[model samples]
Target: MPSEQDLRTKIESGLPDLHNLIVTDISNGCGQSFDVVVISNTFEGKNKLQRSRQINNLLKQEIAQIHAFSCKCYTEAEWSKVVV
Candidate 1:
């Protein structure tokens, strides 16, 4: 089981040029599941599957110890559009 902060830090380090990251524990504080949002320039040229694979590889270890995991990745430009 990995805490939100732990996963956040791991992702932050693994993904360079990170614009934003949000890690939520969806397992009711049990740390068994997580939902993550990642925004970074590193993902600028990638498609959805490519972005997800990057995250999945980065969190492979932590993910193995958890039950459920979901991630959404976007470039800073893409995120701004979504938020606006």
Candidate 2:
């Protein structure tokens, strides 16, 4: 079973240079579901599907075992506006 810390590490490693990322285990400690938020300059030109694909590809193995996965992706500028 993957722990929250394990998931966080994998995501950070996969998406190097990510800024202000958040990964939450929404499954009440079961590690079966996740809600992820990531902000990166790399996402500047990507559409939602493309961004999702990028993350899903990186975490493919880990995702295979999970019941659900949700992601909210943003570019640095977008993140700044939304967070403030």
lDDT of 1 by residue, 9-40 (tens): 89988889999998999889999989999999
Each model's Cα RMSD = 0.7, 1.1
Extract clashing residue pairs from model 2: none
Q: Candidate 2, 59: how far from true, in Å?
A: 0.5
| Candidate 1 least-lDDT 10 residues | 6-15
| Candidate 1 wrong stretches, greater than 4 Å | none
Model 2 Cα displacement at 30 (Å)?
0.8
State which candidate has the highest lDDT. Answer: 1
Q: Quick one: RMSD of model 1?
A: 0.7
Q: What would the per-residue lDDT of candidate 2 be over residues 1-84, giving only the tens digit for each residue?
A: 676787788878888668878889989999999998988888888999999999888788889989999988999999889979
TM-score versus the correct structure, for each prediction = 0.96, 0.92
